[model samples]
Target: MNLIDFLFLVFATLAVGGGLLMIFSRHPVSAAMFMIISMVSVAGLFVLLESFFLAILQVLVYAGAVMVLFLFIIMLLDVGPEGSKSSKIKLLSGLAGVVCFGILMVFSLILVLNSYPECSSCAVWPTLDDNNLVLGQSLVFSTSVKSFGFGLFSKYMLPIQVAGFLLLAAMVGVIILSKKFVREGNPS
Candidate 1:
Protein backbone atom coordinates (compact mmCIF):
# COMPACT_ATOMS: atom_id res chain seq x y z
CA MET A 1 0.00 0.00 0.00
CA ASN A 2 2.50 2.62 1.23
CA LEU A 3 6.23 2.81 0.54
CA ILE A 4 7.15 1.33 3.91
CA ASP A 5 4.64 -1.48 3.52
CA PHE A 6 5.88 -2.21 0.02
CA LEU A 7 9.49 -2.24 1.17
CA PHE A 8 8.60 -4.50 4.09
CA LEU A 9 6.86 -6.98 1.81
CA VAL A 10 9.78 -6.96 -0.59
CA PHE A 11 12.32 -7.55 2.15
CA ALA A 12 10.24 -10.21 3.83
CA THR A 13 9.76 -12.06 0.55
CA LEU A 14 13.46 -11.87 -0.29
CA ALA A 15 14.44 -13.11 3.15
CA VAL A 16 12.08 -16.07 3.12
CA GLY A 17 12.73 -17.01 -0.49
CA GLY A 18 16.47 -16.82 -0.07
CA GLY A 19 16.33 -18.96 3.06
CA LEU A 20 14.26 -21.63 1.34
CA LEU A 21 16.53 -21.61 -1.67
CA MET A 22 19.55 -21.89 0.57
CA ILE A 23 18.09 -24.89 2.36
CA PHE A 24 17.10 -26.67 -0.85
CA SER A 25 20.30 -25.98 -2.73
CA ARG A 26 22.64 -28.89 -3.22
CA HIS A 27 25.72 -26.77 -3.81
CA PRO A 28 27.29 -25.34 -0.68
CA VAL A 29 28.50 -22.22 -2.50
CA SER A 30 25.07 -21.47 -3.91
CA ALA A 31 23.53 -22.01 -0.51
CA ALA A 32 26.00 -19.58 1.03
CA MET A 33 25.17 -16.96 -1.58
CA PHE A 34 21.47 -17.39 -0.92
CA MET A 35 22.16 -17.04 2.79
CA ILE A 36 23.91 -13.73 2.11
CA ILE A 37 20.85 -12.56 0.22
CA SER A 38 18.68 -13.58 3.16
CA MET A 39 20.98 -11.78 5.59
CA VAL A 40 20.93 -8.58 3.56
CA SER A 41 17.15 -8.71 3.34
CA VAL A 42 17.03 -9.15 7.10
CA ALA A 43 19.20 -6.05 7.36
CA GLY A 44 16.68 -4.24 5.20
CA LEU A 45 13.93 -5.35 7.58
CA PHE A 46 15.99 -4.03 10.50
CA VAL A 47 16.34 -0.71 8.68
CA LEU A 48 12.56 -0.63 8.22
CA LEU A 49 12.23 -1.08 11.99
CA GLU A 50 14.32 2.13 12.39
CA SER A 51 17.12 0.23 14.09
CA PHE A 52 20.13 1.51 12.18
CA PHE A 53 22.71 -0.08 14.48
CA LEU A 54 21.09 -3.49 14.06
CA ALA A 55 20.86 -2.99 10.33
CA ILE A 56 24.54 -2.15 10.13
CA LEU A 57 25.27 -5.15 12.32
CA GLN A 58 23.15 -7.40 10.13
CA VAL A 59 25.10 -6.21 7.09
CA LEU A 60 28.58 -6.09 8.60
CA VAL A 61 28.67 -8.97 11.04
CA TYR A 62 26.34 -11.43 9.30
CA ALA A 63 26.20 -10.67 5.58
CA GLY A 64 29.81 -9.50 5.42
CA ALA A 65 32.05 -11.20 7.95
CA VAL A 66 30.22 -14.44 8.63
CA MET A 67 29.38 -15.06 5.00
CA VAL A 68 32.95 -14.43 3.97
CA LEU A 69 34.11 -16.90 6.56
CA PHE A 70 31.60 -19.48 5.42
CA LEU A 71 32.48 -18.96 1.77
CA PHE A 72 36.18 -19.28 2.48
CA ILE A 73 35.63 -22.54 4.33
CA ILE A 74 33.45 -23.89 1.57
CA MET A 75 36.11 -23.06 -0.98
CA LEU A 76 38.86 -24.63 1.10
CA LEU A 77 36.82 -27.80 1.46
CA ASP A 78 36.31 -27.98 -2.32
CA VAL A 79 32.76 -29.06 -1.72
CA GLY A 80 30.64 -30.16 -4.64
CA PRO A 81 26.91 -30.33 -5.18
CA GLU A 82 25.29 -33.19 -3.37
CA GLY A 83 24.95 -36.46 -5.24
CA SER A 84 21.62 -38.08 -5.96
CA LYS A 85 20.05 -39.86 -3.04
CA SER A 86 18.36 -43.29 -3.03
CA SER A 87 14.80 -43.13 -4.33
CA LYS A 88 13.43 -44.42 -1.06
CA ILE A 89 15.26 -41.77 0.92
CA LYS A 90 14.19 -39.09 -1.50
CA LEU A 91 10.55 -40.19 -1.31
CA LEU A 92 10.56 -40.14 2.47
CA SER A 93 12.25 -36.75 2.59
CA GLY A 94 9.78 -35.36 0.10
CA LEU A 95 6.90 -36.65 2.17
CA ALA A 96 8.36 -35.10 5.32
CA GLY A 97 8.82 -31.75 3.60
CA VAL A 98 5.23 -31.85 2.34
CA VAL A 99 3.97 -32.60 5.82
CA CYS A 100 5.92 -29.70 7.25
CA PHE A 101 4.67 -27.38 4.52
CA GLY A 102 1.11 -28.45 5.16
CA ILE A 103 1.47 -27.71 8.86
CA LEU A 104 2.88 -24.25 8.11
CA MET A 105 0.05 -23.58 5.64
CA VAL A 106 -2.50 -24.52 8.26
CA PHE A 107 -0.96 -22.13 10.76
CA SER A 108 -0.83 -19.37 8.18
CA LEU A 109 -4.47 -19.97 7.20
CA ILE A 110 -5.50 -19.84 10.84
CA LEU A 111 -3.78 -16.48 11.27
CA VAL A 112 -5.46 -15.17 8.14
CA LEU A 113 -8.80 -16.56 9.21
CA ASN A 114 -8.47 -14.63 12.47
CA SER A 115 -7.58 -11.50 10.46
CA TYR A 116 -4.17 -11.31 12.17
CA PRO A 117 -4.94 -9.94 15.60
CA GLU A 118 -2.88 -7.05 16.90
CA CYS A 119 0.13 -8.25 18.83
CA SER A 120 0.25 -7.89 22.60
CA SER A 121 3.41 -6.92 24.39
CA CYS A 122 4.48 -8.20 27.76
CA ALA A 123 6.48 -5.08 28.62
CA VAL A 124 5.74 -1.71 27.12
CA TRP A 125 8.94 0.25 26.74
CA PRO A 126 8.69 3.93 27.60
CA THR A 127 9.28 6.79 25.23
CA LEU A 128 12.10 9.03 26.41
CA ASP A 129 13.60 12.36 25.49
CA ASP A 130 16.44 14.33 27.04
CA ASN A 131 14.04 15.68 29.66
CA ASN A 132 12.87 12.17 30.53
CA LEU A 133 16.48 11.07 31.01
CA VAL A 134 17.05 14.09 33.19
CA LEU A 135 14.01 13.03 35.18
CA GLY A 136 15.69 9.57 35.75
CA GLN A 137 13.63 7.76 33.13
CA SER A 138 16.68 6.39 31.36
CA LEU A 139 15.19 2.96 30.68
CA VAL A 140 13.32 3.80 27.52
CA PHE A 141 13.33 2.64 23.90
CA SER A 142 14.65 4.90 21.20
CA THR A 143 16.41 4.80 17.85
CA SER A 144 19.68 5.77 19.48
CA VAL A 145 22.65 3.49 20.06
CA LYS A 146 22.38 4.04 23.84
CA SER A 147 18.89 2.61 24.09
CA PHE A 148 19.92 -0.23 21.78
CA GLY A 149 22.84 -1.01 24.03
CA PHE A 150 20.58 -0.81 27.07
CA GLY A 151 18.18 -3.31 25.50
CA LEU A 152 20.98 -5.66 24.55
CA PHE A 153 22.50 -5.54 27.99
CA SER A 154 19.36 -5.56 30.10
CA LYS A 155 16.73 -7.50 28.18
CA TYR A 156 18.55 -9.50 25.49
CA MET A 157 21.71 -10.41 27.37
CA LEU A 158 21.00 -14.12 27.60
CA PRO A 159 20.35 -14.54 23.91
CA ILE A 160 23.51 -12.54 23.13
CA GLN A 161 25.61 -14.78 25.36
CA VAL A 162 24.00 -17.89 23.89
CA ALA A 163 24.81 -16.74 20.36
CA GLY A 164 28.41 -16.03 21.32
CA PHE A 165 28.71 -19.46 22.86
CA LEU A 166 27.22 -21.10 19.78
CA LEU A 167 29.70 -19.30 17.53
CA LEU A 168 32.56 -20.43 19.73
CA ALA A 169 31.25 -23.99 19.66
CA ALA A 170 30.92 -23.90 15.91
CA MET A 171 34.49 -22.71 15.57
CA VAL A 172 35.67 -25.52 17.81
CA GLY A 173 33.57 -28.04 15.93
CA VAL A 174 35.06 -26.94 12.63
CA ILE A 175 38.57 -27.38 13.96
CA ILE A 176 37.73 -30.80 15.31
CA LEU A 177 36.10 -31.92 12.10
CA SER A 178 38.93 -30.67 9.91
CA LYS A 179 41.77 -32.09 11.98
CA LYS A 180 43.58 -35.07 10.49
CA PHE A 181 43.93 -37.92 12.89
CA VAL A 182 46.73 -40.45 12.44
CA ARG A 183 46.32 -44.08 13.46
CA GLU A 184 48.13 -44.93 16.68
CA GLY A 185 50.45 -47.53 15.13
CA ASN A 186 50.91 -46.15 11.61
CA PRO A 187 52.77 -42.89 11.38
CA SER A 188 51.84 -42.56 7.71
Candidate 2:
Protein backbone atom coordinates (compact mmCIF):
# COMPACT_ATOMS: atom_id res chain seq x y z
CA MET A 1 0.00 0.00 0.00
CA ASN A 2 1.14 3.51 -0.84
CA LEU A 3 1.50 6.33 1.73
CA ILE A 4 -1.68 8.02 0.50
CA ASP A 5 -3.66 4.80 0.87
CA PHE A 6 -2.32 4.29 4.38
CA LEU A 7 -3.21 7.82 5.40
CA PHE A 8 -6.69 7.46 3.95
CA LEU A 9 -7.28 4.27 5.91
CA VAL A 10 -6.10 5.93 9.12
CA PHE A 11 -8.37 8.94 8.72
CA ALA A 12 -11.33 6.83 7.65
CA THR A 13 -10.93 4.56 10.68
CA LEU A 14 -10.70 7.56 13.00
CA ALA A 15 -13.85 9.09 11.50
CA VAL A 16 -15.88 5.86 11.82
CA GLY A 17 -14.61 5.03 15.28
CA GLY A 18 -15.35 8.54 16.51
CA GLY A 19 -18.86 8.35 15.14
CA LEU A 20 -19.49 5.04 16.93
CA LEU A 21 -18.03 6.37 20.16
CA MET A 22 -20.20 9.49 19.92
CA ILE A 23 -23.33 7.38 19.56
CA PHE A 24 -22.48 5.10 22.49
CA SER A 25 -21.21 7.74 24.92
CA ARG A 26 -23.48 8.33 27.91
CA HIS A 27 -22.28 11.85 28.64
CA PRO A 28 -23.48 14.67 26.40
CA VAL A 29 -20.12 16.44 26.56
CA SER A 30 -18.19 13.28 25.67
CA ALA A 31 -20.50 12.67 22.72
CA ALA A 32 -19.96 16.21 21.48
CA MET A 33 -16.21 15.86 21.76
CA PHE A 34 -16.31 12.56 19.86
CA MET A 35 -18.40 14.27 17.14
CA ILE A 36 -15.72 16.93 16.84
CA ILE A 37 -13.10 14.23 16.38
CA SER A 38 -15.20 12.66 13.62
CA MET A 39 -15.62 16.02 11.90
CA VAL A 40 -11.90 16.74 12.04
CA SER A 41 -11.12 13.30 10.63
CA VAL A 42 -13.51 13.94 7.74
CA ALA A 43 -11.68 17.23 7.10
CA GLY A 44 -8.43 15.32 6.98
CA LEU A 45 -9.92 12.96 4.39
CA PHE A 46 -10.96 16.02 2.34
CA VAL A 47 -7.40 17.32 2.50
CA LEU A 48 -6.11 13.94 1.30
CA LEU A 49 -8.45 14.23 -1.69
CA GLU A 50 -6.81 17.58 -2.52
CA SER A 51 -9.89 19.61 -1.67
CA PHE A 52 -8.09 22.10 0.55
CA PHE A 53 -10.91 24.64 0.37
CA LEU A 54 -13.49 22.02 1.39
CA ALA A 55 -11.23 20.70 4.16
CA ILE A 56 -10.78 24.16 5.66
CA LEU A 57 -14.48 24.91 5.38
CA GLN A 58 -15.34 21.57 7.02
CA VAL A 59 -13.06 22.38 9.97
CA LEU A 60 -14.29 25.97 10.27
CA VAL A 61 -17.99 25.31 9.85
CA TYR A 62 -18.47 21.88 11.41
CA ALA A 63 -15.61 21.35 13.85
CA GLY A 64 -15.37 24.99 14.93
CA ALA A 65 -18.71 26.78 14.68
CA VAL A 66 -21.17 23.88 14.81
CA MET A 67 -19.38 22.09 17.63
CA VAL A 68 -19.22 25.31 19.65
CA LEU A 69 -22.95 25.80 19.14
CA PHE A 70 -23.63 22.21 20.23
CA LEU A 71 -21.48 22.63 23.33
CA PHE A 72 -23.30 25.86 24.16
CA ILE A 73 -26.69 24.16 23.79
CA ILE A 74 -25.63 21.30 26.03
CA MET A 75 -24.43 23.69 28.71
CA LEU A 76 -27.54 25.85 28.48
CA LEU A 77 -29.80 22.82 28.73
CA ASP A 78 -27.77 21.38 31.59
CA VAL A 79 -27.67 17.99 29.88
CA GLY A 80 -25.69 15.11 31.35
CA PRO A 81 -25.43 11.33 31.17
CA GLU A 82 -28.68 9.60 30.46
CA GLY A 83 -30.57 8.25 33.47
CA SER A 84 -31.43 4.60 33.92
CA LYS A 85 -34.56 3.25 32.27
CA SER A 86 -36.60 0.05 32.69
CA SER A 87 -34.99 -3.16 31.35
CA LYS A 88 -37.79 -3.64 28.84
CA ILE A 89 -37.32 -0.13 27.43
CA LYS A 90 -33.54 -0.60 27.28
CA LEU A 91 -33.90 -3.93 25.49
CA LEU A 92 -36.31 -2.43 22.98
CA SER A 93 -33.98 0.48 22.27
CA GLY A 94 -31.01 -1.88 21.80
CA LEU A 95 -32.99 -4.06 19.42
CA ALA A 96 -34.05 -0.99 17.43
CA GLY A 97 -30.44 0.16 17.19
CA VAL A 98 -29.32 -3.25 15.96
CA VAL A 99 -32.06 -3.36 13.33
CA CYS A 100 -31.12 0.13 12.12
CA PHE A 101 -27.47 -0.90 11.88
CA GLY A 102 -28.39 -3.98 9.84
CA ILE A 103 -30.47 -1.84 7.46
CA LEU A 104 -27.64 0.65 7.06
CA MET A 105 -25.17 -2.15 6.35
CA VAL A 106 -27.41 -3.60 3.67
CA PHE A 107 -27.82 -0.22 1.99
CA SER A 108 -24.09 0.42 2.09
CA LEU A 109 -23.37 -2.98 0.54
CA ILE A 110 -25.86 -2.33 -2.25
CA LEU A 111 -24.37 1.07 -2.98
CA VAL A 112 -20.86 -0.34 -3.12
CA LEU A 113 -21.95 -3.13 -5.45
CA ASN A 114 -23.81 -0.76 -7.78
CA SER A 115 -21.27 2.07 -7.92
CA TYR A 116 -18.20 0.06 -8.83
CA PRO A 117 -16.88 1.34 -12.14
CA GLU A 118 -16.75 -1.07 -15.07
CA CYS A 119 -13.82 0.81 -16.58
CA SER A 120 -10.60 0.36 -14.63
CA SER A 121 -9.35 3.82 -15.70
CA CYS A 122 -12.40 5.77 -14.59
CA ALA A 123 -11.28 8.82 -12.65
CA VAL A 124 -13.58 10.67 -10.25
CA TRP A 125 -11.54 13.90 -10.43
CA PRO A 126 -8.93 15.32 -12.82
CA THR A 127 -5.32 14.89 -11.83
CA LEU A 128 -3.58 18.18 -11.16
CA ASP A 129 -0.15 18.76 -12.71
CA ASP A 130 0.87 21.05 -9.88
CA ASN A 131 -0.98 20.68 -6.59
CA ASN A 132 -0.16 24.27 -5.60
CA LEU A 133 -1.80 25.65 -8.75
CA VAL A 134 -5.05 23.73 -8.19
CA LEU A 135 -6.46 26.35 -5.86
CA GLY A 136 -5.29 29.46 -7.73
CA GLN A 137 -5.94 28.36 -11.31
CA SER A 138 -7.67 25.00 -11.87
CA LEU A 139 -10.62 25.17 -9.46
CA VAL A 140 -10.71 28.91 -8.77
CA PHE A 141 -14.29 29.48 -9.83
CA SER A 142 -15.45 26.13 -8.52
CA THR A 143 -13.99 25.92 -5.01
CA SER A 144 -12.47 29.27 -4.06
CA VAL A 145 -13.77 31.72 -1.45
CA LYS A 146 -14.91 34.12 -4.18
CA SER A 147 -16.89 31.40 -5.90
CA PHE A 148 -18.45 30.35 -2.58
CA GLY A 149 -19.46 33.97 -1.85
CA PHE A 150 -20.96 34.40 -5.29
CA GLY A 151 -22.92 31.15 -5.11
CA LEU A 152 -24.15 31.89 -1.57
CA PHE A 153 -25.37 35.35 -2.45
CA SER A 154 -26.72 34.56 -5.91
CA LYS A 155 -28.21 31.08 -5.80
CA TYR A 156 -28.83 30.49 -2.08
CA MET A 157 -29.57 33.95 -0.75
CA LEU A 158 -33.14 33.15 0.27
CA PRO A 159 -32.21 29.94 2.06
CA ILE A 160 -29.39 31.68 3.90
CA GLN A 161 -31.70 34.46 5.09
CA VAL A 162 -34.32 31.93 6.18
CA ALA A 163 -31.77 29.94 8.13
CA GLY A 164 -30.51 33.09 9.85
CA PHE A 165 -34.06 34.03 10.89
CA LEU A 166 -34.73 30.51 12.15
CA LEU A 167 -31.57 30.56 14.27
CA LEU A 168 -32.51 33.95 15.70
CA ALA A 169 -35.99 32.68 16.58
CA ALA A 170 -34.57 29.60 18.25
CA MET A 171 -32.19 31.73 20.35
CA VAL A 172 -35.04 33.97 21.42
CA GLY A 173 -37.16 30.96 22.31
CA VAL A 174 -34.43 29.44 24.42
CA ILE A 175 -33.98 32.70 26.31
CA ILE A 176 -37.74 33.02 26.93
CA LEU A 177 -38.01 29.40 28.07
CA SER A 178 -35.11 29.77 30.50
CA LYS A 179 -36.56 32.96 31.93
CA LYS A 180 -39.97 31.35 32.40
CA PHE A 181 -38.47 28.36 34.14
CA VAL A 182 -36.49 30.61 36.46
CA ARG A 183 -39.58 32.64 37.35
CA GLU A 184 -41.57 29.48 38.08
CA GLY A 185 -38.75 28.18 40.30
CA ASN A 186 -38.70 24.93 38.34
CA PRO A 187 -35.30 24.79 36.69
CA SER A 188 -35.79 21.12 35.95
Candidate 3:
Protein backbone atom coordinates (compact mmCIF):
# COMPACT_ATOMS: atom_id res chain seq x y z
CA MET A 1 0.00 0.00 0.00
CA ASN A 2 0.92 3.68 -0.25
CA LEU A 3 2.64 5.60 2.57
CA ILE A 4 -0.55 7.52 3.41
CA ASP A 5 -2.60 4.30 3.57
CA PHE A 6 0.03 2.65 5.79
CA LEU A 7 0.07 5.64 8.13
CA PHE A 8 -3.75 5.66 8.25
CA LEU A 9 -3.74 1.98 9.17
CA VAL A 10 -1.21 2.58 11.92
CA PHE A 11 -3.18 5.47 13.40
CA ALA A 12 -6.50 3.62 13.12
CA THR A 13 -5.05 0.54 14.81
CA LEU A 14 -3.61 2.66 17.62
CA ALA A 15 -6.93 4.46 18.08
CA VAL A 16 -8.96 1.25 18.29
CA GLY A 17 -6.41 -0.58 20.40
CA GLY A 18 -6.14 2.30 22.83
CA GLY A 19 -9.94 2.48 23.12
CA LEU A 20 -10.16 -1.25 23.92
CA LEU A 21 -7.33 -0.96 26.44
CA MET A 22 -9.00 2.04 28.06
CA ILE A 23 -12.25 0.11 28.43
CA PHE A 24 -10.58 -2.98 29.94
CA SER A 25 -8.13 -1.20 32.25
CA ARG A 26 -8.89 -1.73 35.96
CA HIS A 27 -7.09 1.43 37.07
CA PRO A 28 -8.80 4.77 36.40
CA VAL A 29 -5.48 6.55 35.74
CA SER A 30 -4.39 3.91 33.25
CA ALA A 31 -7.76 4.09 31.52
CA ALA A 32 -7.45 7.88 31.25
CA MET A 33 -3.97 7.58 29.77
CA PHE A 34 -5.21 5.04 27.24
CA MET A 35 -8.06 7.41 26.35
CA ILE A 36 -5.50 10.18 25.73
CA ILE A 37 -3.58 7.88 23.42
CA SER A 38 -6.78 7.05 21.53
CA MET A 39 -7.65 10.74 21.18
CA VAL A 40 -4.19 11.63 19.91
CA SER A 41 -4.26 8.78 17.41
CA VAL A 42 -7.65 9.98 16.16
CA ALA A 43 -6.16 13.47 15.78
CA GLY A 44 -3.41 11.91 13.65
CA LEU A 45 -6.08 10.29 11.48
CA PHE A 46 -7.67 13.74 11.02
CA VAL A 47 -4.31 15.08 9.87
CA LEU A 48 -4.06 12.23 7.33
CA LEU A 49 -7.46 13.29 5.97
CA GLU A 50 -5.96 16.77 5.32
CA SER A 51 -8.11 18.40 8.01
CA PHE A 52 -5.30 20.19 9.86
CA PHE A 53 -7.74 22.50 11.61
CA LEU A 54 -9.76 19.56 12.91
CA ALA A 55 -6.59 17.71 13.90
CA ILE A 56 -5.34 20.67 15.96
CA LEU A 57 -8.76 21.14 17.53
CA GLN A 58 -8.99 17.43 18.35
CA VAL A 59 -5.58 17.43 20.08
CA LEU A 60 -6.24 20.72 21.85
CA VAL A 61 -9.77 19.94 23.03
CA TYR A 62 -9.69 16.21 23.68
CA ALA A 63 -6.05 15.20 24.23
CA GLY A 64 -5.01 18.37 26.06
CA ALA A 65 -7.95 19.98 27.88
CA VAL A 66 -10.41 17.12 28.36
CA MET A 67 -7.73 14.57 29.23
CA VAL A 68 -6.13 16.93 31.75
CA LEU A 69 -9.52 17.51 33.37
CA PHE A 70 -10.22 13.77 33.40
CA LEU A 71 -6.79 13.02 34.88
CA PHE A 72 -7.30 15.71 37.51
CA ILE A 73 -10.66 14.25 38.48
CA ILE A 74 -9.19 10.74 38.66
CA MET A 75 -6.35 11.99 40.88
CA LEU A 76 -8.71 14.01 43.06
CA LEU A 77 -10.93 10.98 43.61
CA ASP A 78 -7.92 8.83 44.57
CA VAL A 79 -9.45 5.93 42.71
CA GLY A 80 -7.93 2.52 43.25
CA PRO A 81 -7.68 -0.57 41.08
CA GLU A 82 -10.98 -2.38 40.65
CA GLY A 83 -11.61 -5.52 42.65
CA SER A 84 -11.09 -8.76 40.78
CA LYS A 85 -14.21 -10.49 39.53
CA SER A 86 -15.04 -14.13 40.30
CA SER A 87 -14.03 -16.61 37.61
CA LYS A 88 -17.66 -17.66 37.11
CA ILE A 89 -18.73 -14.03 36.71
CA LYS A 90 -15.88 -13.37 34.30
CA LEU A 91 -16.76 -16.45 32.25
CA LEU A 92 -20.41 -15.40 32.00
CA SER A 93 -19.45 -11.83 31.09
CA GLY A 94 -17.08 -13.10 28.43
CA LEU A 95 -19.73 -15.36 26.98
CA ALA A 96 -22.23 -12.49 26.83
CA GLY A 97 -19.63 -10.22 25.23
CA VAL A 98 -18.84 -12.83 22.59
CA VAL A 99 -22.51 -13.22 21.74
CA CYS A 100 -22.96 -9.46 21.43
CA PHE A 101 -19.87 -9.22 19.24
CA GLY A 102 -21.18 -11.99 16.99
CA ILE A 103 -24.48 -10.17 16.60
CA LEU A 104 -22.70 -6.91 15.77
CA MET A 105 -20.53 -8.67 13.21
CA VAL A 106 -23.60 -10.12 11.50
CA PHE A 107 -25.22 -6.69 11.31
CA SER A 108 -22.03 -5.16 9.95
CA LEU A 109 -21.68 -7.86 7.33
CA ILE A 110 -25.25 -7.28 6.20
CA LEU A 111 -24.65 -3.52 5.98
CA VAL A 112 -21.52 -4.01 3.91
CA LEU A 113 -23.27 -6.44 1.57
CA ASN A 114 -26.20 -4.08 0.98
CA SER A 115 -24.15 -0.91 0.54
CA TYR A 116 -23.68 0.47 -2.99
CA PRO A 117 -21.43 3.17 -4.35
CA GLU A 118 -22.93 6.62 -5.03
CA CYS A 119 -22.65 8.47 -8.35
CA SER A 120 -19.10 9.79 -8.64
CA SER A 121 -20.11 12.89 -10.58
CA CYS A 122 -22.60 14.16 -7.96
CA ALA A 123 -21.54 17.44 -6.34
CA VAL A 124 -20.88 17.33 -2.58
CA TRP A 125 -22.44 20.00 -0.39
CA PRO A 126 -20.40 23.00 0.82
CA THR A 127 -18.21 22.41 -2.20
CA LEU A 128 -14.46 22.52 -1.62
CA ASP A 129 -14.16 24.19 -5.04
CA ASP A 130 -11.87 27.21 -5.19
CA ASN A 131 -14.54 29.24 -6.97
CA ASN A 132 -16.89 29.51 -3.97
CA LEU A 133 -15.83 32.67 -2.11
CA VAL A 134 -16.71 33.61 1.46
CA LEU A 135 -16.38 37.07 3.13
CA GLY A 136 -13.49 38.61 1.16
CA GLN A 137 -11.43 37.67 -1.92
CA SER A 138 -8.14 37.99 -0.02
CA LEU A 139 -8.29 34.54 1.58
CA VAL A 140 -10.14 31.36 0.60
CA PHE A 141 -12.21 30.13 3.56
CA SER A 142 -12.51 26.41 4.29
CA THR A 143 -15.99 25.18 3.41
CA SER A 144 -15.87 22.43 6.03
CA VAL A 145 -15.43 24.96 8.85
CA LYS A 146 -17.91 27.39 7.33
CA SER A 147 -20.60 24.73 6.79
CA PHE A 148 -19.95 23.25 10.25
CA GLY A 149 -20.39 26.66 11.92
CA PHE A 150 -23.52 27.43 9.89
CA GLY A 151 -25.13 24.06 10.67
CA LEU A 152 -24.18 24.21 14.35
CA PHE A 153 -25.40 27.78 14.86
CA SER A 154 -28.49 27.58 12.68
CA LYS A 155 -30.11 24.13 12.56
CA TYR A 156 -28.63 22.39 15.60
CA MET A 157 -28.47 25.42 17.90
CA LEU A 158 -31.18 24.27 20.30
CA PRO A 159 -29.74 20.77 20.74
CA ILE A 160 -26.24 22.19 21.13
CA GLN A 161 -27.42 24.68 23.77
CA VAL A 162 -29.26 21.93 25.63
CA ALA A 163 -26.20 19.69 25.54
CA GLY A 164 -24.02 22.56 26.82
CA PHE A 165 -26.46 23.20 29.68
CA LEU A 166 -26.54 19.50 30.52
CA LEU A 167 -22.73 19.38 30.56
CA LEU A 168 -22.62 22.47 32.82
CA ALA A 169 -25.11 20.88 35.20
CA ALA A 170 -23.13 17.65 35.27
CA MET A 171 -19.92 19.55 36.01
CA VAL A 172 -21.63 21.41 38.86
CA GLY A 173 -22.95 18.11 40.22
CA VAL A 174 -19.50 16.53 40.09
CA ILE A 175 -17.99 19.51 41.92
CA ILE A 176 -20.69 19.29 44.59
CA LEU A 177 -20.24 15.56 44.95
CA SER A 178 -16.46 15.84 45.29
CA LYS A 179 -16.52 18.64 47.83
CA LYS A 180 -15.08 17.59 51.21
CA PHE A 181 -16.91 19.12 54.17
CA VAL A 182 -14.81 19.69 57.28
CA ARG A 183 -16.47 19.94 60.67
CA GLU A 184 -15.90 23.35 62.32
CA GLY A 185 -15.09 22.07 65.84
CA ASN A 186 -13.37 18.79 65.10
CA PRO A 187 -9.57 19.13 65.44
CA SER A 188 -8.69 15.44 65.10
Best by TM-score: 2
What is the alpha-carbon lDDT of model 3 when measured against the actual structure?
Answer: 0.84
Cα deviation of 112, candidate 2, in Å: 2.6
Candidate 3 lDDT trough over 10 residues, lowest sum: 132-141
Clashing pairs in 3: none
Residue-pair clash count for candidate 2: 0
Candidate 3 C-alpha lDDT tens digits along 154-187: 6678999999999999999988998997888995
TM-score of each: 0.72, 0.73, 0.72
lDDT per model vs. reference: 0.86, 0.85, 0.84
**Residue-by-residue lDDT tens digits, candidate 1, 1-188:** 99998999999999999999999999999999999999999999998877788899889999999899999989898989989989999999999999999999999999887985556863333443532312254465456787666667877899999989999999999899989999998999
For 75-167, candidate 2 gives per-residue lDDT tens digits of 999987998999999999999999999999999999998997667686766554432323533333343456666656766799999999999
TM-score of 3: 0.72
After superposition, the stretches of candidate 2 with alpha carbons farther than 4 Å from their true spots are: 73-80, 128-141, 181-188
Better of 1 and 3 by lDDT: 1
